[model samples]
Target chain A: MTQFNPVSQSAGGQASFIAVDWGTTNLRAFLMNQDGHIQAQRDSDRGMLKLGSAEFESVLSDLLGDWLTPDLPIYMAGMVGSRGGWQEVPYQQCPIKLEDLSEHLFWLTTSLPNKVAIVPGLRGTGVAGLLDVMRGEETQLLGALDWLEEQGRADESPIFCLPGTHCKWAQITEGKVTQFSTSITGELFARLNDESSLVKGLPKSNQLNEDAFKKGVQASLQAGGILHHLFSARSRFVCGELAADEVRDYLSGVVIGHDVNDTLEALKVVSLEVPKSPVLIIGSEALSERYALALSSRDLTSEFLAANEASIRGLKRLANRQAVSANNPTTGAL
Target chain B: MTQFNPVSQSAGGQASFIAVDWGTTNLRAFLMNQDGHIQAQRDSDRGMLKLGSAEFESVLSDLLGDWLTPDLPIYMAGMVGSRGGWQEVPYQQCPIKLEDLSEHLFWLTTSLPNKVAIVPGLRGTGVAGLLDVMRGEETQLLGALDWLEEQGRADESPIFCLPGTHCKWAQITEGKVTQFSTSITGELFARLNDESSLVKGLPKSNQLNEDAFKKGVQASLQAGGILHHLFSARSRFVCGELAADEVRDYLSGVVIGHDVNDTLEALKVVSLEVPKSPVLIIGSEALSERYALALSSRDLTSEFLAANEASIRGLKRLANRQAVSANNPTTGAL
Candidate 1:
């Protein structure tokens, strides 16, 4: 990783292309060199939910500033390609290969005289045996697989866990996304923060109480499951067993613990109880650490991949594939 | 039940006593005769959470109006005796009997010249093997037991299920509440309504969609448990399998179904799988109906009891017990 020297990159270094990961609540833009190294990056709150249909082009243009030069290819993924985004790019059906994502790109020619390609999401059967779709996380999964391939672990089928508001657990085999499931754990935790009995009399600081969190994780392993375990956040407090400040983290542990347990159980094939390999956890450091802790509790190991890096790698993979297909007519179909 | 004729009651009916159920969000005052018949009932928003420490007396006086006679005794339960309530009455230890509660009442003489007794809550081991306490529901359970006693089933060890913001499943053996477990199902449902992906395009009507709710109940019986089942609300919607109006009810079913299942499982003793008798569900008609549906899904039958009647009965029982103890000083210790 290079230290961000904005002046040096803006004046001397040749800008190769731009990659963007636009989600529901925020947007991240990365300027990358030909070698897939990020020269500069920017983030904004102008996500899909915050913009009007007509405002997408203007928002992107302003976000890019001087980088919006003619002939500069741009790649974008996530909610930016959803039905409510800048363009409604239909999801590519699974099992979809990471390399073929570029072929299914929804292309748009902006007023800046540059062609922008929006990567399509993936659709498959979820953990509940129902059709599930993920817009932004698919790109991250693709990028994480790219990291695995570079490490010579290409043939190993690994479970990718992405922790977020809607945590996703995906299975990838030979660079193809076979299946995935989502657990609304983080979203539920945030909701409980405002209205749950666990929130009452909570401490003002946002720092997590680790002891309480661990106790919650242990609680999740007990009988009664998530529904019964949830009330303990309040019941313990009322009985003077848990302090008010510890309630929030305790609830977090409960929710996240359930998510990890259920996801791992869902991943089982032929009624197998034990996991075969170490899971790949991709997300922010804090969330991944919590998931890692949960996985560790279950005698499972995990490897961490930063979500931002995965997104950039995924967008770069799509762009490189597009370039190769454009130059070689025989491989145009990707 | 007699028709509510306010003018007739205000003019000549002899006021027996005021039975009050003051919870966190709302308060109910029932003017009952000596026979436990309600002459008139009044509900207000000035619950424990809504009143300041000094405002309790004035609020109760104002709410009672002409019923605030010096000779009239007031018996209050629920959060009225909680830490944030009018007076922080300590909780009574569990394995408690209905006939013994009056002896443990926290009696207070107000400036209004009437002595008010607040019912103490019960504390015992919860579902997680941690200490649990229920403030208002203990009184309701007492009244529910009285209902059973009237039905000639007082000696039967029936499981009483109370559905509300915090649903409780209590085991009563020979008119004593031996133990109970609470599920934060209702609060979780309400929280999800505002902050969940399931609520994105939900219909404005509060009415439950029966078909959708049934589907959700069925979904709960499947693999992955509640955490994974929750995301199906969004997954099905994204796949065009579920309508916007169905999302809310479906989510409701998932939460309630899990609550019922876990509670019933927790009730099992000596590894017994089947429940011995029909579960008694005590609450408002609407909420009880939901629980009944979920219970039916599990091949379990449930009997419904109005929460108001139970509160009145419970309060009357406590008052009657106090009267009997007054006559026999040897049994006053309870």
Candidate 2:
């Protein structure tokens, strides 16, 4: 791999670029020089959910001002472009290239004189004939691809599972994300534990009780149907077997069981072979660990990737490509 | 029909009977004599979701003081016998008869001086099998059968649909419940509307907009998929085409759509040859209205039966039979 120097021929000197990945509940920003070295970073709770459209620009500008000057060019992604975000930028359908996204990009000039370009999220009609939506993850997947290409191991169509509030599994072929599916497993877990009667009497505990989760998973898999397994959760509690805290794990198992089942079923419809294939998981440590356990339960091998690293690397690759295109007008596709 | 009166029986001759129909969220009880007159009626918040095995008897006693007095025969049914309920009473498979239920009856009596018999819910397994769990409704269906027998309309196999929390469809042949299936349509609706994000932002109102509900039923019948029509409510809201309160109607549409789809699907599997058959719908007025609208949407006809009436009649029939069977060796099969 070639290492570029941290210098650029600006009229006076070198300057750093900023990349922001914004989601519903959080915002993460990365500052990189010309060489793709992370010079600074910032995070804030002024996410899309907290900041409605009217207050988004001011809140974001206030946060970014601490990290960089007002005139910096900022590239953003994630729910910042969603209907509920700063601007309602339409989604670019999947099997989409970076250039397709770049073409449909929305630029906003803040009163503080900063130039901001928000990356469009990807949307696609899945094989199941349902609309699948994603925002910041597509950019991260592109970055993972760039990293793989740098390593000279980017030939295989790797299954990238990005697990978070909304778990996304994308199939990357060559350098493009061909298709993906989203599961609301995390949100369902949170709601069931906090608001639902399924765990009404349960105690608060965050520790993953593998035994209880496994029991739930097994019961969910073996039960005749979804409704039957739902009752079993209550039955387990009533039978004096499951602790209140363990209900969370059981709920997780129920959701994961359904998710895996549906995903596998969807894959079969598309004739995608999963077993013995490489599965790449990207997310937080805890979620990745859970995914790993779930995969192992189904006798599948998986590789874990750090989500932050992937997103940063992806932004770096985007920056590099943009820089190269600026230098060679017709050589690099923008 | 023979009218037998037992008003002149001795004080001890009056058989004390306890009748109960324990549903998911409600429990109703009736104290009766040998003459099958409701001496007193009671209810409590001690539904299946609230109480467990340890508290079941105490809750019952608290609700019924004189009713639980010495020598009273307590008969109960509904979710109380479910696996998640107070006790794990095994299900009596479908094609079950009154005699079958009586033969396999399980009794639970404590030192509280009252005889208690918890009626078993129905269960069916194997290929093309179905299980219907009814505590109060089963007795209602039995009561309906007794009414039919008295009316000399017992020869025909009447199709009875009890639509409520769990909609039960039973085929009665020769005054016996030959087969029945339970659909958790009510529970599903409650969960989806109250808990799911599908209609999270929609306003709540109970006014039944029949026009919107009918439109939804039509769309459901034509489209044959739920998710497609689910977003109609949101779309209607976004486009300013629907009132905030009309969300109830939109919900009605989605649920009725599902109910119609499920009914049609189940009917297909069961291979009902006569589309214009005289189906009996026994349920609450609100649900019965919905069912009537659904049937009309499909160009099918049905006779509506009040759930409470059927249940009361059924309990009376049980009490009357018990009174006669105590004296006659073979008056009733049980």
Candidate 3:
């Protein structure tokens, strides 16, 4: 039931630490040296959704293996910190300084030396003053800011688009996350394609049909908005205008296109530089490129920072600040 | 496997015919006399979705029971005429006179008798020139139009909104369906409330929470569009701004509100009298009321007609034209 948080007696000299990006469907870990350079890495399907709350300790410990030393602190982000996850860490409110994430680290109360902690997610005011929340992506945002600072582009406020099942569009003012909105674009596409009558008999294909994808993006830019554009998939397919192999990608375009469009529109309501400002996409190369294509189709520029690297940089940044936070934690007592 | 279409020899003297509204999930039949009066009605869950193409005849015959007679013609509408239904009746293009439906009836070639036919669905160019398809809704639209004409409102080009699993918005100009669009509002709401993570831990209920539902409608009018508005359900729930019991209705509000908003916007792109014109809503009292609530919040005037009346009147209207069609069919041969 327990991986017995690595005994403090066995931990002497270790300049290494572990960073785990544990989300709903996937998990990845990194072992970094004193300089925040990756020494080793491991990836698994043991996501928080697949494990019971009690199993988190064991699964995580076995994952770390030799890397699981008491002095080698472990930091986790995403759904592992959610209510049904390992510890249910509370979210920190934003307009939050990305750098202050380490100060809000929720340390687990293990019997042995304390080294395990979850990077708290962020809850911020979204469009129309409604609330929005993000877990792992907040840490990724922290890491992305770190990556941008290294490139000396930190001062230039660019909208961060994290493309995934629940896509997020965040705006950074200075070093703090001023505001952000989440859209279930990917999930909606999946549900309609798989379950709804829209793509009932349509063959499913994973390959992206570039032409259809871009056409869908153009359709999304039209007057009907998404609900109408979505029907266009069924309508076009039935009319034999869109091919069987193109339905999936075309759907991807419609969904992501609206996501990009709606978010930009919402951002424009708050900031003047939105439509003009370039976007920094923090996600996988494949998906981020899709976002990039959707953006470029609208004549907007975008750059990608590998999502994994951003999370690692985010965790390392926190690890560096961990010592400072330990002496004088800014977070209120739970 | 065959229900053996009535042998025609059994005909004596019968003035009754069947009008079937057969859809994906349910089927209903009305035994109507020559005077357009319902003699009897039967309903079943044996929708087209439940039976194979070969089994339609048997199922219909069994449902008809003692009502089955060679002299009685059966006119069916909805998905029953879809490719996977009893027969794959092609869609009739729009800017089409609703009264012309009987001319396009897809008469099935029964060896014994030619009494079975499917009321063909309609195809129309929706927003951005995308082809939109509707199966049963076309017949319902016809019925609604007939009902309107009887009330001396034939010249009025009211937007016909049939809200259901796949809600449809139709514009009828000069007794013809000029344009229409289908929004996956109801289906989207069902999918998110049941399968998506947005309502993962939330309680489900059938009761409509007016406060929450209206809030969602109001939310849709804001800058972020439906995609952003959808996430508000989860975000608001997580922040304790929304209650568990209210999630479902609230979600319905958001989806239906967007459905109403998007379709109206698309209609305005072509028609000048859209937002100002009255909307004739053809659906059940309860569901139509929700739509009415959504419409009224935006200061739009709407009137409801029982969905069943619309379908029956539409079928009766077609029956009156069937003899005319038999003499000179307007539809090209399959």
Candidate 4:
């Protein structure tokens, strides 16, 4: 809810481009300089789900009213380019690099003067040879890789996790997204709280009980798999072992723990010592913290990155990559 | 949905008692003979959730309008005895038998003439020292044990699975319910289909797709646990590997498979061959079929019993036990 209006008079109205992360239920836009720093930022609840395909143009224009101008070069990512989004952009096949993303961008021809390009989401084989898709998180992963490079860890291919409703865990190998899987962890947690027996008589509280959460994480490590473990949230309550207020956080821990643990197991990452690189977690602060706790519980290390920052950086990176590719067409062609 | 109206004038109005299976969503009442045979049966949408505590008496009266008599005794099981139901019957601890249930029954002191008793639910240790509670399934389990006894398998300790909104798996040893676990498989499946991405665009059909379901069972045995396996339902659909209509059954398969698999693992009944006794699946035919299928897929054999029949048998057995205890207090005392 923090509004960042960094557009100052000293900049002399020299904003280079606009970066937008429009997902299922949220829209965040950033005005950046040529150096890829966010100069100003704005957000709204006008996610892709809220706007009709045709209304997207006007909504974007209204949101960025002060920043809009001819030839501003607008770049967008996430569900805004999905089938239910403004433009139904086909998913770009994975084993793709950050440099190749711009070439496969779904270019939107607009009545407005600005050239609009929506980054294509990625499609790849998930666990067990099943197909998985990610729209917005692919951009976040791209930005995370860039952040790693900036940290002089460019050679490191840490697993990048963008946790949200549908959490995406992508493995970056040799600067390319080689493997990834999507787990419906957040959505599942919300749904279980809303509908399952775990929250039946639970008292509502705004406090985040870390102890309860840690207990849940511990429960997840026990036998019976996730399905059986899920019932423990309520059963523990029924037995007077877990308090009403603690059930929610405990359930949260169980789910997040399983999500992290299972994904790692699927990737064949057995021990913390095996993976030399730390896991890179990119999401809202609250969600990332939970993932970090779960990872640490398993003795796996992780680094956090704010989702908004990653989105802006990724959009800017893609834009810059496209600009460079335009000058030398053969090099970055998809 | 088949209504059984078996009350006959030629029998000279000789109905013995009424056995009720009053759960969270539906109510089934059977008019029984002293021999425990159901002479007539009726059902309504007057589940525990549908009626207020004060309205339960009226609802029961309305459902059993013709069968009510001042001298007749009524026995009810399931959520009708839960905290929010007509009467909050306390749960009897595990390692209990059918004979002990009547002694623990929460007898109602009503303004109505007929004597009524709500069977106490059972509470027991589930997986990893966690507690599990079952309201109606205890009666089904009791009845299942009786059926086993009738089959000359009384000495055999078999796992009993009563599948429903919350499935209960009970281990009966020497006529006593020693341990049990409750898995929210049915509720989870229904919630996922209604609310999760797994069945977002799935087509509506009354048919149960066995092939699709079997495939899900196969997938459940693979790596990544239930949380990861859940996403495969949607991911497979996204990749055109699974059709919309097939997704529901597939999800059902995944959930049921995990439920059986996890519970077996928790009980340390690994490889099915370790337990010589076949799993006793007592529930509605539809649900029991699915559980049977899941068990068979794991090379675990199973037997089925009708829930209504089991409830009537259980109620009758408890009532007879109560009568004998009343006649000979010290001999039948718990």
Choose the strongest candidate by DockQ.
3
DockQ versus reference, model 2: 0.13
Selected candidate, larger TM-score, 3 vs 4: 3
* Candidate 3: true interface contacts recovered: 0.77
Off by over 4 Å in 4: A1-13, A269-274, A327-334, B1-13, B269-273, B327-334
Q: Could you report the DockQ of all the candidates, in the order they appear?
A: 0.58, 0.13, 0.66, 0.55
| Candidate 4: docking tier | medium
lDDT of 1 at B274: 57
The superposed Cα distance between candidate 3 and the true structure at residue B123, in angstroms, equals 1.2
Order candidates by DockQ, high to low. Answer: 3, 1, 4, 2
Off by over 4 Å in 2: A1-15, A33-37, A172-174, A236-247, A272-276, A296-299, A326-334, B1-191, B205-310, B324-334
Best by lDDT: 3
Give the TM-score ranking, best first.
3, 1, 4, 2
Candidate 4 or 2, higher lDDT: 4
Candidate 3 — which residues are off by over 4 angstroms?
A: A1-15, A112-114, A275-277, A324-334, B1-14, B111-114, B275-277, B324-334
Tens-place lDDT per residue, model 4, A1-334, is: 1122322222545677789999989888888876568778889999987788989999888898877776467889999987678988878888888657878877777776666788888889766556788888888887887787777788887778888888887877776888778887988888888877668867766667999999999988876667767888877887788988899999999999999888878778422434667888999899999999999998999989999888887887787776665533341123
TM-score of chain A of each: 0.92, 0.88, 0.91, 0.92
Instruction: Please report how far candidate 3 places residue A108 from its true position, in Å.
Output: 0.7
TM-score for chain B of each model, two decimals:
0.91, 0.84, 0.91, 0.91
TM-score of each: 0.93, 0.71, 0.93, 0.92
Clash pairs, candidate 1, are: B78-B136
